[model samples]
Target chain A: MPIDLDEALKAIAHPVRRDMLSWLKDPQRHFPDQEHPLEIGVCAGQFDQRTGLSQSTVSAHLATLQRACLVTSRRVGQWNFFKRNQAAIDELVRRLGEEL
Target chain B: MPIDLDEALKAIAHPVRRDMLSWLKDPQRHFPDQEHPLEIGVCAGQFDQRTGLSQSTVSAHLATLQRACLVTSRRVGQWNFFKRNQAAIDELVRRLGEEL
Candidate 1:
Protein backbone atom coordinates (compact mmCIF):
# COMPACT_ATOMS: atom_id res chain seq x y z
CA MET A 1 0.00 0.00 0.00
CA PRO A 2 1.10 3.56 -0.70
CA ILE A 3 2.10 5.64 2.28
CA ASP A 4 -0.22 8.49 3.30
CA LEU A 5 1.54 11.84 3.71
CA ASP A 6 -0.58 12.97 6.64
CA GLU A 7 -0.16 9.65 8.45
CA ALA A 8 3.60 9.64 7.92
CA LEU A 9 3.92 13.21 9.16
CA LYS A 10 1.83 12.47 12.22
CA ALA A 11 3.78 9.28 12.91
CA ILE A 12 7.12 11.05 12.93
CA ALA A 13 5.80 14.11 14.81
CA HIS A 14 6.81 12.74 18.19
CA PRO A 15 10.43 13.02 19.28
CA VAL A 16 10.66 9.42 20.46
CA ARG A 17 9.16 8.13 17.22
CA ARG A 18 11.62 10.17 15.18
CA ASP A 19 14.48 8.86 17.25
CA MET A 20 13.25 5.34 16.73
CA LEU A 21 13.40 5.88 12.97
CA SER A 22 16.97 7.16 13.21
CA TRP A 23 17.99 4.12 15.17
CA LEU A 24 16.22 1.81 12.78
CA LYS A 25 17.98 3.37 9.81
CA ASP A 26 21.40 2.18 11.03
CA PRO A 27 20.72 -0.80 13.25
CA GLN A 28 24.31 -2.03 13.23
CA ARG A 29 25.58 1.27 14.54
CA HIS A 30 22.75 2.16 16.96
CA PHE A 31 21.88 -1.34 18.12
CA PRO A 32 25.14 -3.26 18.05
CA ASP A 33 24.04 -5.65 20.78
CA GLN A 34 20.99 -6.84 18.90
CA GLU A 35 21.06 -10.63 18.50
CA HIS A 36 19.07 -10.94 15.28
CA PRO A 37 20.82 -10.56 11.95
CA LEU A 38 20.71 -7.01 10.52
CA GLU A 39 18.99 -8.19 7.34
CA ILE A 40 15.59 -8.62 9.06
CA GLY A 41 16.00 -5.41 11.12
CA VAL A 42 15.74 -4.85 14.84
CA CYS A 43 13.30 -6.65 17.06
CA ALA A 44 10.68 -4.92 19.19
CA GLY A 45 12.44 -6.03 22.37
CA GLN A 46 15.57 -4.12 21.40
CA PHE A 47 13.60 -0.92 21.30
CA ASP A 48 12.07 -1.65 24.67
CA GLN A 49 15.51 -2.32 26.13
CA ARG A 50 17.20 0.66 24.47
CA THR A 51 14.50 3.22 25.24
CA GLY A 52 13.96 1.95 28.78
CA LEU A 53 10.29 2.59 28.19
CA SER A 54 7.45 0.18 28.89
CA GLN A 55 6.85 -2.53 26.28
CA SER A 56 3.36 -1.17 25.63
CA THR A 57 4.71 2.32 24.92
CA VAL A 58 7.26 1.02 22.43
CA SER A 59 4.61 -1.19 20.85
CA ALA A 60 2.30 1.77 20.37
CA HIS A 61 5.00 3.84 18.67
CA LEU A 62 5.95 0.93 16.43
CA ALA A 63 2.30 0.44 15.53
CA THR A 64 2.04 4.10 14.51
CA LEU A 65 5.09 3.84 12.23
CA GLN A 66 3.83 0.60 10.70
CA ARG A 67 0.40 2.13 10.10
CA ALA A 68 2.06 5.01 8.25
CA CYS A 69 4.03 2.51 6.12
CA LEU A 70 7.24 4.22 7.17
CA VAL A 71 8.52 0.87 8.44
CA THR A 72 7.75 -2.72 7.63
CA SER A 73 7.41 -5.36 10.33
CA ARG A 74 8.27 -9.04 10.14
CA ARG A 75 7.57 -11.92 12.44
CA VAL A 76 10.51 -14.15 13.41
CA GLY A 77 9.23 -16.84 15.75
CA GLN A 78 7.83 -14.87 18.71
CA TRP A 79 9.40 -11.47 17.99
CA ASN A 80 8.48 -8.79 15.51
CA PHE A 81 11.30 -7.01 13.67
CA PHE A 82 11.08 -3.64 11.94
CA LYS A 83 13.08 -1.88 9.28
CA ARG A 84 12.71 1.40 7.39
CA ASN A 85 10.72 1.19 4.20
CA GLN A 86 13.25 3.01 2.05
CA ALA A 87 10.98 3.09 -0.99
CA ALA A 88 8.21 4.71 0.98
CA ILE A 89 10.67 7.16 2.54
CA ASP A 90 12.01 8.09 -0.88
CA GLU A 91 8.48 8.43 -2.23
CA LEU A 92 7.64 10.77 0.63
CA VAL A 93 10.63 12.96 -0.16
CA ARG A 94 9.71 13.04 -3.82
CA ARG A 95 6.13 13.93 -2.99
CA LEU A 96 7.24 16.65 -0.62
CA GLY A 97 9.53 18.07 -3.26
CA GLU A 98 6.66 18.20 -5.74
CA GLU A 99 3.73 18.89 -3.41
CA LEU A 100 5.20 20.89 -0.52
CA MET B 1 17.31 29.92 10.00
CA PRO B 2 17.19 26.15 9.96
CA ILE B 3 13.83 24.49 9.47
CA ASP B 4 12.99 22.19 12.37
CA LEU B 5 11.79 18.79 11.23
CA ASP B 6 9.10 18.42 13.88
CA GLU B 7 7.75 21.90 13.26
CA ALA B 8 7.65 21.47 9.49
CA LEU B 9 5.94 18.09 9.82
CA LYS B 10 3.39 19.58 12.22
CA ALA B 11 2.85 22.61 10.00
CA ILE B 12 2.10 20.50 6.94
CA ALA B 13 0.01 17.95 8.84
CA HIS B 14 -3.22 19.79 8.14
CA PRO B 15 -4.75 19.30 4.68
CA VAL B 16 -5.45 23.04 4.27
CA ARG B 17 -1.91 23.93 5.25
CA ARG B 18 -0.53 21.39 2.79
CA ASP B 19 -2.77 22.82 0.04
CA MET B 20 -1.60 26.31 0.91
CA LEU B 21 1.99 25.18 0.42
CA SER B 22 1.09 23.72 -2.95
CA TRP B 23 -0.65 26.96 -4.02
CA LEU B 24 2.28 29.07 -2.85
CA LYS B 25 4.66 26.86 -4.80
CA ASP B 26 3.17 28.01 -8.11
CA PRO B 27 1.62 31.36 -7.37
CA GLN B 28 1.28 32.46 -11.00
CA ARG B 29 -0.52 29.24 -11.84
CA HIS B 30 -2.65 28.77 -8.72
CA PHE B 31 -3.43 32.36 -7.80
CA PRO B 32 -3.65 34.38 -10.99
CA ASP B 33 -5.81 37.07 -9.48
CA GLN B 34 -3.13 37.95 -6.91
CA GLU B 35 -2.39 41.67 -7.36
CA HIS B 36 1.16 41.38 -6.14
CA PRO B 37 3.99 40.37 -8.44
CA LEU B 38 4.82 36.67 -8.48
CA GLU B 39 8.33 37.45 -7.21
CA ILE B 40 7.11 38.76 -3.86
CA GLY B 41 4.55 35.94 -3.66
CA VAL B 42 0.82 35.86 -3.05
CA CYS B 43 -0.67 38.17 -0.47
CA ALA B 44 -2.74 37.04 2.51
CA GLY B 45 -5.94 38.25 0.88
CA GLN B 46 -5.40 35.98 -2.13
CA PHE B 47 -5.53 32.94 0.08
CA ASP B 48 -8.74 34.18 1.65
CA GLN B 49 -10.32 35.02 -1.72
CA ARG B 50 -9.24 31.79 -3.35
CA THR B 51 -10.29 29.49 -0.52
CA GLY B 52 -13.36 31.52 0.50
CA LEU B 53 -12.08 31.16 4.03
CA SER B 54 -12.05 33.86 6.69
CA GLN B 55 -9.02 36.16 6.90
CA SER B 56 -8.22 35.24 10.50
CA THR B 57 -8.30 31.52 9.77
CA VAL B 58 -5.99 31.96 6.81
CA SER B 59 -3.73 34.14 8.88
CA ALA B 60 -3.46 31.47 11.53
CA HIS B 61 -2.47 28.81 9.01
CA LEU B 62 0.05 31.17 7.43
CA ALA B 63 1.49 31.87 10.84
CA THR B 64 1.93 28.16 11.47
CA LEU B 65 3.75 27.66 8.17
CA GLN B 66 5.91 30.73 8.78
CA ARG B 67 6.78 29.54 12.26
CA ALA B 68 7.92 26.22 10.83
CA CYS B 69 10.10 28.06 8.24
CA LEU B 70 8.25 26.30 5.44
CA VAL B 71 7.27 29.70 4.06
CA THR B 72 8.79 33.15 4.29
CA SER B 73 6.60 36.22 4.74
CA ARG B 74 7.25 39.69 3.43
CA ARG B 75 5.35 42.84 4.33
CA VAL B 76 4.45 45.23 1.50
CA GLY B 77 2.35 48.15 2.65
CA GLN B 78 -0.32 46.49 4.83
CA TRP B 79 -0.27 43.12 3.13
CA ASN B 80 1.92 40.19 4.07
CA PHE B 81 3.16 38.20 1.10
CA PHE B 82 4.11 34.56 1.60
CA LYS B 83 6.34 32.41 -0.57
CA ARG B 84 7.75 28.90 -0.24
CA ASN B 85 11.22 28.88 1.30
CA GLN B 86 12.66 26.47 -1.20
CA ALA B 87 16.03 26.23 0.52
CA ALA B 88 14.44 25.45 3.86
CA ILE B 89 12.06 23.00 2.27
CA ASP B 90 14.98 21.25 0.58
CA GLU B 91 16.89 21.20 3.83
CA LEU B 92 13.90 19.58 5.48
CA VAL B 93 13.80 16.90 2.79
CA ARG B 94 17.51 16.29 3.09
CA ARG B 95 17.22 15.93 6.83
CA LEU B 96 14.38 13.49 6.44
CA GLY B 97 16.41 11.47 4.00
CA GLU B 98 19.34 11.30 6.42
CA GLU B 99 17.59 11.24 9.78
CA LEU B 100 14.19 9.68 9.20
Candidate 2:
Protein backbone atom coordinates (compact mmCIF):
# COMPACT_ATOMS: atom_id res chain seq x y z
CA MET A 1 0.00 0.00 0.00
CA PRO A 2 1.13 3.53 -0.79
CA ILE A 3 2.19 5.44 2.30
CA ASP A 4 -0.02 8.32 3.43
CA LEU A 5 2.40 11.13 4.11
CA ASP A 6 -0.09 13.24 6.09
CA GLU A 7 -1.16 10.30 8.22
CA ALA A 8 2.44 9.27 8.81
CA LEU A 9 3.35 12.78 9.87
CA LYS A 10 0.40 12.92 12.27
CA ALA A 11 1.20 9.47 13.61
CA ILE A 12 4.76 10.35 14.57
CA ALA A 13 3.82 13.69 16.12
CA HIS A 14 3.31 12.07 19.50
CA PRO A 15 6.25 10.97 21.67
CA VAL A 16 4.76 7.60 22.59
CA ARG A 17 4.06 6.74 18.97
CA ARG A 18 7.55 7.77 17.93
CA ASP A 19 9.07 5.78 20.79
CA MET A 20 7.05 2.76 19.70
CA LEU A 21 8.64 2.98 16.25
CA SER A 22 12.10 3.31 17.79
CA TRP A 23 11.55 0.25 19.97
CA LEU A 24 10.17 -1.79 17.08
CA LYS A 25 13.28 -0.98 15.05
CA ASP A 26 15.19 -3.52 17.18
CA PRO A 27 12.70 -5.95 18.65
CA GLN A 28 15.27 -8.45 19.84
CA ARG A 29 17.11 -5.83 21.83
CA HIS A 30 14.05 -4.00 23.11
CA PHE A 31 11.68 -6.88 23.66
CA PRO A 32 13.88 -9.63 25.05
CA ASP A 33 11.08 -11.39 26.91
CA GLN A 34 9.04 -12.26 23.84
CA GLU A 35 8.85 -16.04 23.18
CA HIS A 36 8.25 -15.53 19.46
CA PRO A 37 11.21 -14.70 17.26
CA LEU A 38 11.81 -11.20 15.87
CA GLU A 39 10.65 -12.40 12.44
CA ILE A 40 7.04 -12.07 13.55
CA GLY A 41 7.96 -8.81 15.29
CA VAL A 42 7.20 -7.93 18.93
CA CYS A 43 3.89 -8.91 20.40
CA ALA A 44 1.41 -6.26 21.57
CA GLY A 45 1.65 -7.47 25.16
CA GLN A 46 5.36 -6.79 25.13
CA PHE A 47 4.69 -3.20 24.10
CA ASP A 48 2.25 -2.77 26.98
CA GLN A 49 4.84 -4.04 29.37
CA ARG A 50 7.69 -2.04 27.87
CA THR A 51 5.75 1.22 27.74
CA GLY A 52 4.06 0.64 31.10
CA LEU A 53 0.86 1.77 29.47
CA SER A 54 -2.50 0.05 29.41
CA GLN A 55 -3.06 -2.58 26.77
CA SER A 56 -5.85 -0.55 25.15
CA THR A 57 -3.72 2.56 25.11
CA VAL A 58 -0.78 0.73 23.53
CA SER A 59 -3.07 -0.91 21.05
CA ALA A 60 -4.56 2.44 20.10
CA HIS A 61 -1.11 3.91 19.53
CA LEU A 62 -0.09 0.87 17.48
CA ALA A 63 -3.27 1.20 15.45
CA THR A 64 -2.41 4.82 14.69
CA LEU A 65 1.08 3.83 13.48
CA GLN A 66 -0.38 1.00 11.43
CA ARG A 67 -2.92 3.36 9.91
CA ALA A 68 -0.08 5.65 8.87
CA CYS A 69 1.74 2.69 7.28
CA LEU A 70 4.66 3.34 9.59
CA VAL A 71 4.15 -0.09 11.16
CA THR A 72 2.69 -3.42 10.15
CA SER A 73 0.82 -5.81 12.42
CA ARG A 74 -0.04 -9.50 12.21
CA ARG A 75 -2.44 -11.53 14.32
CA VAL A 76 -0.82 -14.70 15.63
CA GLY A 77 -3.83 -16.60 16.99
CA GLN A 78 -4.46 -14.51 20.15
CA TRP A 79 -1.66 -11.97 20.14
CA ASN A 80 -0.88 -9.29 17.59
CA PHE A 81 2.70 -8.73 16.45
CA PHE A 82 4.01 -5.45 15.04
CA LYS A 83 7.13 -4.43 13.16
CA ARG A 84 8.38 -1.30 11.51
CA ASN A 85 7.30 -0.84 7.93
CA GLN A 86 10.80 0.14 6.87
CA ALA A 87 10.00 0.63 3.19
CA ALA A 88 7.17 3.06 3.85
CA ILE A 89 9.32 4.86 6.38
CA ASP A 90 12.15 5.16 3.86
CA GLU A 91 9.78 6.47 1.21
CA LEU A 92 8.39 9.00 3.70
CA VAL A 93 11.87 10.29 4.44
CA ARG A 94 12.73 10.43 0.72
CA ARG A 95 9.56 12.26 -0.17
CA LEU A 96 10.01 14.68 2.74
CA GLY A 97 13.53 15.42 1.50
CA GLU A 98 12.32 16.15 -2.03
CA GLU A 99 8.91 17.62 -1.37
CA LEU A 100 9.04 19.22 2.10
CA MET B 1 19.08 26.54 17.23
CA PRO B 2 18.33 22.84 17.27
CA ILE B 3 15.36 21.68 15.25
CA ASP B 4 12.47 20.30 17.32
CA LEU B 5 11.61 17.06 15.56
CA ASP B 6 8.33 16.57 17.42
CA GLU B 7 7.22 20.12 16.78
CA ALA B 8 8.20 19.95 13.12
CA LEU B 9 6.28 16.72 12.70
CA LYS B 10 3.25 18.25 14.43
CA ALA B 11 3.43 21.39 12.31
CA ILE B 12 3.52 19.51 9.02
CA ALA B 13 0.66 17.26 10.07
CA HIS B 14 -1.85 19.84 8.90
CA PRO B 15 -2.41 20.04 5.13
CA VAL B 16 -2.39 23.84 5.00
CA ARG B 17 0.85 24.01 6.92
CA ARG B 18 2.42 21.39 4.63
CA ASP B 19 1.21 23.33 1.60
CA MET B 20 2.67 26.47 3.11
CA LEU B 21 6.09 24.82 3.35
CA SER B 22 5.78 23.54 -0.23
CA TRP B 23 4.92 27.05 -1.40
CA LEU B 24 7.77 28.69 0.51
CA LYS B 25 10.22 26.22 -1.04
CA ASP B 26 10.18 28.32 -4.23
CA PRO B 27 9.12 31.80 -3.22
CA GLN B 28 9.50 33.46 -6.60
CA ARG B 29 7.42 30.75 -8.24
CA HIS B 30 4.81 30.19 -5.49
CA PHE B 31 4.54 33.80 -4.49
CA PRO B 32 4.79 36.67 -6.95
CA ASP B 33 3.66 40.32 -7.24
CA GLN B 34 5.44 41.26 -4.04
CA GLU B 35 7.33 44.55 -3.93
CA HIS B 36 10.26 43.08 -2.00
CA PRO B 37 12.77 40.59 -3.44
CA LEU B 38 13.20 36.94 -2.51
CA GLU B 39 15.93 37.87 -0.03
CA ILE B 40 13.25 38.80 2.49
CA GLY B 41 11.20 35.75 1.52
CA VAL B 42 7.43 35.96 0.75
CA CYS B 43 5.40 38.48 2.66
CA ALA B 44 2.57 37.19 4.88
CA GLY B 45 0.05 39.12 2.78
CA GLN B 46 0.75 36.94 -0.23
CA PHE B 47 -0.04 33.88 1.84
CA ASP B 48 -3.38 35.35 2.85
CA GLN B 49 -4.16 36.06 -0.80
CA ARG B 50 -3.04 32.65 -2.03
CA THR B 51 -4.78 30.72 0.69
CA GLY B 52 -7.86 32.96 0.73
CA LEU B 53 -7.69 32.81 4.50
CA SER B 54 -7.99 35.66 6.98
CA GLN B 55 -4.79 37.41 7.94
CA SER B 56 -5.11 36.26 11.54
CA THR B 57 -5.69 32.67 10.47
CA VAL B 58 -2.72 32.84 8.13
CA SER B 59 -0.63 34.35 10.87
CA ALA B 60 -1.62 31.53 13.22
CA HIS B 61 -0.60 28.93 10.68
CA LEU B 62 2.70 30.71 10.03
CA ALA B 63 3.29 30.92 13.76
CA THR B 64 2.79 27.18 14.06
CA LEU B 65 5.35 26.55 11.34
CA GLN B 66 7.76 29.01 12.92
CA ARG B 67 7.40 27.33 16.31
CA ALA B 68 8.28 24.03 14.62
CA CYS B 69 11.42 25.58 13.07
CA LEU B 70 10.17 24.39 9.72
CA VAL B 71 9.98 28.02 8.58
CA THR B 72 11.61 31.23 9.71
CA SER B 73 10.17 34.72 9.55
CA ARG B 74 11.68 38.20 9.45
CA ARG B 75 9.87 41.38 10.39
CA VAL B 76 10.26 43.55 7.33
CA GLY B 77 8.78 46.77 8.70
CA GLN B 78 5.13 45.93 9.48
CA TRP B 79 5.05 42.73 7.38
CA ASN B 80 6.69 39.42 8.13
CA PHE B 81 8.61 37.68 5.35
CA PHE B 82 8.63 33.93 5.80
CA LYS B 83 10.92 31.35 4.23
CA ARG B 84 11.82 27.70 4.56
CA ASN B 85 14.71 26.82 6.86
CA GLN B 86 16.42 24.54 4.38
CA ALA B 87 19.24 23.53 6.70
CA ALA B 88 16.91 22.57 9.51
CA ILE B 89 14.71 20.78 7.00
CA ASP B 90 17.68 18.85 5.63
CA GLU B 91 18.78 17.96 9.13
CA LEU B 92 15.26 16.85 9.94
CA VAL B 93 15.18 14.49 6.97
CA ARG B 94 18.62 13.13 7.81
CA ARG B 95 17.67 12.59 11.42
CA LEU B 96 14.40 10.97 10.47
CA GLY B 97 16.30 8.56 8.27
CA GLU B 98 18.40 7.51 11.24
CA GLU B 99 16.07 8.04 14.16
CA LEU B 100 12.55 7.44 12.89
Candidate 3:
Protein backbone atom coordinates (compact mmCIF):
# COMPACT_ATOMS: atom_id res chain seq x y z
CA MET A 1 0.00 0.00 0.00
CA PRO A 2 1.08 3.58 -0.64
CA ILE A 3 2.17 5.47 2.47
CA ASP A 4 -0.40 7.99 3.59
CA LEU A 5 1.08 11.27 2.36
CA ASP A 6 -0.96 13.49 4.67
CA GLU A 7 -0.02 11.51 7.75
CA ALA A 8 3.62 11.32 6.70
CA LEU A 9 3.77 15.05 6.09
CA LYS A 10 2.08 15.72 9.39
CA ALA A 11 4.55 13.46 11.19
CA ILE A 12 7.48 15.11 9.49
CA ALA A 13 6.33 18.72 9.78
CA HIS A 14 7.67 19.18 13.29
CA PRO A 15 11.25 20.57 13.33
CA VAL A 16 12.59 18.19 15.97
CA ARG A 17 11.11 15.11 14.32
CA ARG A 18 12.56 16.15 10.96
CA ASP A 19 15.95 16.54 12.59
CA MET A 20 15.45 13.23 14.37
CA LEU A 21 15.22 11.41 11.03
CA SER A 22 18.38 13.11 9.77
CA TRP A 23 20.23 12.37 13.00
CA LEU A 24 19.13 8.74 13.10
CA LYS A 25 20.24 8.25 9.50
CA ASP A 26 23.83 7.99 10.71
CA PRO A 27 23.59 6.31 14.08
CA GLN A 28 27.27 5.48 14.37
CA ARG A 29 28.24 9.13 13.96
CA HIS A 30 25.53 10.73 16.07
CA PHE A 31 24.34 8.49 18.90
CA PRO A 32 26.10 6.74 21.78
CA ASP A 33 26.80 3.03 21.63
CA GLN A 34 23.69 1.07 22.51
CA GLU A 35 23.59 -1.34 25.41
CA HIS A 36 22.02 -3.82 23.03
CA PRO A 37 23.56 -4.37 19.58
CA LEU A 38 23.32 -1.08 17.67
CA GLU A 39 22.11 -2.91 14.57
CA ILE A 40 18.72 -3.30 16.22
CA GLY A 41 18.42 0.50 16.61
CA VAL A 42 19.27 3.38 18.91
CA CYS A 43 17.65 3.26 22.32
CA ALA A 44 14.98 5.85 23.14
CA GLY A 45 17.04 7.02 26.08
CA GLN A 46 19.77 8.14 23.72
CA PHE A 47 17.26 9.96 21.55
CA ASP A 48 15.77 11.60 24.58
CA GLN A 49 19.21 12.76 25.71
CA ARG A 50 20.43 13.95 22.29
CA THR A 51 17.14 15.72 21.63
CA GLY A 52 17.31 17.46 25.00
CA LEU A 53 13.65 16.62 25.39
CA SER A 54 11.83 14.94 28.23
CA GLN A 55 11.23 11.17 28.00
CA SER A 56 7.51 11.74 27.53
CA THR A 57 8.07 14.27 24.73
CA VAL A 58 10.48 11.96 22.92
CA SER A 59 8.04 9.10 23.21
CA ALA A 60 5.25 11.21 21.75
CA HIS A 61 7.42 12.27 18.82
CA LEU A 62 8.59 8.73 18.13
CA ALA A 63 5.01 7.46 18.33
CA THR A 64 3.99 9.99 15.69
CA LEU A 65 6.86 8.95 13.43
CA GLN A 66 5.94 5.29 13.89
CA ARG A 67 2.31 5.96 13.05
CA ALA A 68 3.41 7.58 9.78
CA CYS A 69 5.68 4.59 8.95
CA LEU A 70 8.62 6.97 8.66
CA VAL A 71 10.18 5.32 11.69
CA THR A 72 10.00 1.83 13.18
CA SER A 73 10.34 0.77 16.79
CA ARG A 74 11.24 -2.44 18.55
CA ARG A 75 11.47 -3.43 22.21
CA VAL A 76 14.23 -5.64 23.59
CA GLY A 77 14.10 -6.43 27.29
CA GLN A 78 12.72 -3.07 28.50
CA TRP A 79 14.32 -0.50 26.19
CA ASN A 80 12.66 0.84 23.05
CA PHE A 81 14.77 1.35 19.92
CA PHE A 82 13.94 3.48 16.90
CA LYS A 83 15.25 3.38 13.32
CA ARG A 84 14.21 5.03 10.11
CA ASN A 85 11.94 3.17 7.66
CA GLN A 86 13.80 3.91 4.42
CA ALA A 87 11.22 2.17 2.22
CA ALA A 88 8.41 4.33 3.52
CA ILE A 89 10.50 7.47 3.17
CA ASP A 90 11.40 6.57 -0.41
CA GLU A 91 7.77 5.81 -1.15
CA LEU A 92 6.88 9.31 0.04
CA VAL A 93 9.45 10.79 -2.33
CA ARG A 94 8.06 8.69 -5.18
CA ARG A 95 4.50 9.77 -4.43
CA LEU A 96 5.49 13.42 -4.23
CA GLY A 97 7.22 13.22 -7.59
CA GLU A 98 4.31 11.43 -9.23
CA GLU A 99 1.45 13.38 -7.66
CA LEU A 100 2.94 16.82 -6.98
CA MET B 1 17.21 31.46 0.68
CA PRO B 2 16.24 27.84 1.31
CA ILE B 3 12.56 27.02 1.16
CA ASP B 4 11.14 26.54 4.67
CA LEU B 5 10.71 22.75 4.66
CA ASP B 6 8.45 22.72 7.72
CA GLU B 7 6.07 25.29 6.28
CA ALA B 8 6.14 23.71 2.82
CA LEU B 9 5.40 20.26 4.21
CA LYS B 10 2.54 21.64 6.27
CA ALA B 11 1.11 23.47 3.26
CA ILE B 12 1.22 20.39 1.08
CA ALA B 13 -0.24 18.11 3.76
CA HIS B 14 -3.85 18.88 2.96
CA PRO B 15 -5.41 16.40 0.50
CA VAL B 16 -7.27 19.02 -1.53
CA ARG B 17 -4.19 21.23 -1.74
CA ARG B 18 -2.03 18.28 -2.81
CA ASP B 19 -4.49 17.46 -5.58
CA MET B 20 -4.61 21.11 -6.52
CA LEU B 21 -0.88 21.17 -7.26
CA SER B 22 -1.12 17.99 -9.36
CA TRP B 23 -4.11 19.34 -11.25
CA LEU B 24 -2.52 22.73 -11.86
CA LYS B 25 0.54 20.98 -13.30
CA ASP B 26 -1.10 20.51 -16.70
CA PRO B 27 -3.57 23.34 -16.96
CA GLN B 28 -4.52 22.53 -20.55
CA ARG B 29 -5.27 18.93 -19.65
CA HIS B 30 -7.32 19.70 -16.57
CA PHE B 31 -9.01 23.11 -16.91
CA PRO B 32 -10.97 24.99 -19.52
CA ASP B 33 -9.39 27.82 -21.56
CA GLN B 34 -9.12 30.96 -19.54
CA GLU B 35 -10.90 34.19 -20.47
CA HIS B 36 -7.37 35.49 -20.14
CA PRO B 37 -4.60 33.82 -22.16
CA LEU B 38 -3.57 30.34 -20.96
CA GLU B 39 0.14 31.04 -21.33
CA ILE B 40 0.14 33.12 -18.14
CA GLY B 41 -1.59 30.59 -15.79
CA VAL B 42 -4.94 29.33 -14.58
CA CYS B 43 -7.32 31.75 -12.94
CA ALA B 44 -8.50 31.13 -9.37
CA GLY B 45 -12.09 31.01 -10.57
CA GLN B 46 -11.42 27.77 -12.43
CA PHE B 47 -9.52 26.29 -9.48
CA ASP B 48 -12.37 27.19 -7.15
CA GLN B 49 -14.83 25.60 -9.57
CA ARG B 50 -12.83 22.43 -10.16
CA THR B 51 -11.95 21.91 -6.50
CA GLY B 52 -15.64 22.06 -5.44
CA LEU B 53 -14.46 24.31 -2.62
CA SER B 54 -15.66 27.70 -1.60
CA GLN B 55 -13.77 30.63 -3.10
CA SER B 56 -12.56 31.71 0.34
CA THR B 57 -11.29 28.20 1.15
CA VAL B 58 -9.47 27.93 -2.18
CA SER B 59 -7.90 31.31 -1.62
CA ALA B 60 -6.69 30.28 1.81
CA HIS B 61 -5.09 27.12 0.43
CA LEU B 62 -3.43 29.06 -2.40
CA ALA B 63 -2.09 31.60 0.05
CA THR B 64 -0.42 28.85 2.02
CA LEU B 65 1.14 27.38 -1.13
CA GLN B 66 2.34 30.83 -2.13
CA ARG B 67 3.83 31.44 1.30
CA ALA B 68 5.70 28.15 0.99
CA CYS B 69 6.98 29.19 -2.49
CA LEU B 70 5.46 26.02 -3.95
CA VAL B 71 3.21 28.19 -6.16
CA THR B 72 3.51 31.65 -7.68
CA SER B 73 0.89 34.11 -8.77
CA ARG B 74 0.70 36.89 -11.34
CA ARG B 75 -1.77 39.69 -11.86
CA VAL B 76 -2.81 40.84 -15.32
CA GLY B 77 -5.67 43.30 -15.72
CA GLN B 78 -7.87 42.11 -12.85
CA TRP B 79 -7.59 38.27 -12.78
CA ASN B 80 -5.08 36.37 -10.64
CA PHE B 81 -2.94 33.75 -12.37
CA PHE B 82 -1.24 30.87 -10.57
CA LYS B 83 1.44 28.42 -11.67
CA ARG B 84 3.81 26.00 -9.99
CA ASN B 85 7.24 27.20 -8.91
CA GLN B 86 9.27 24.23 -10.10
CA ALA B 87 12.51 25.51 -8.57
CA ALA B 88 10.95 25.74 -5.15
CA ILE B 89 9.40 22.29 -5.59
CA ASP B 90 12.80 20.86 -6.60
CA GLU B 91 14.38 22.50 -3.58
CA LEU B 92 11.75 20.89 -1.37
CA VAL B 93 12.55 17.51 -2.93
CA ARG B 94 16.26 18.04 -2.33
CA ARG B 95 15.70 19.00 1.30
CA LEU B 96 13.52 15.93 1.88
CA GLY B 97 16.15 13.59 0.42
CA GLU B 98 18.97 15.10 2.45
CA GLU B 99 17.12 15.69 5.70
CA LEU B 100 14.41 13.04 5.83
Q: What TM-score would each prediction reach against the true structure?
A: 0.86, 0.92, 0.93
Looking at candidate 1 chain B, the ten consecutive residues that score lowest on lDDT are B91-100
Docking outcome class, model 3: high
* Recovered fraction of real interface contacts per model: 0.83, 0.85, 0.85
Chain B TM-score in each of the candidates:
0.92, 0.92, 0.93
lDDT of 1 by residue, A10-90 (tens): 888788899998898789988899888978989999999989999999999999999999899999899999999889888
lDDT of 2 at A20: 92
Model 2: native contacts recovered, as a fraction: 0.85
Model 1 misplaced stretches (Cα beyond 4 Å): A36-39, A76-78
Candidate 3: stretches off by over 4 Å: none
Q: Which portions of model 2 show Cα errors greater than 4 Å?
A: none
lDDT of 2 by residue, B2-96 (tens): 78888989888788888899998778888778889988888999999999999999999999999988888899788899999888888888888
Which residue pairs show backbone clashes in model 2? none
Candidate 1 lDDT over residue span B1-100, tens digit each:
7777888899988889999988877788898876668798789999998888999999999999999998898999998999998898889878876776
Candidate 3 chain A: minimum summed lDDT over ten consecutive residues — where?
A29-38
lDDT for each residue of candidate 3 in B12-87, tens digit (9 for 90 to 100) = 9999988888887888888865677777988988888898899999999999999999999999888788999889
Q: Give the higher-DockQ candidate: 1 or 3.
A: 3
lDDT of 2 by residue, A2-48 (tens): 78888999898888998999998888789988899889888999989
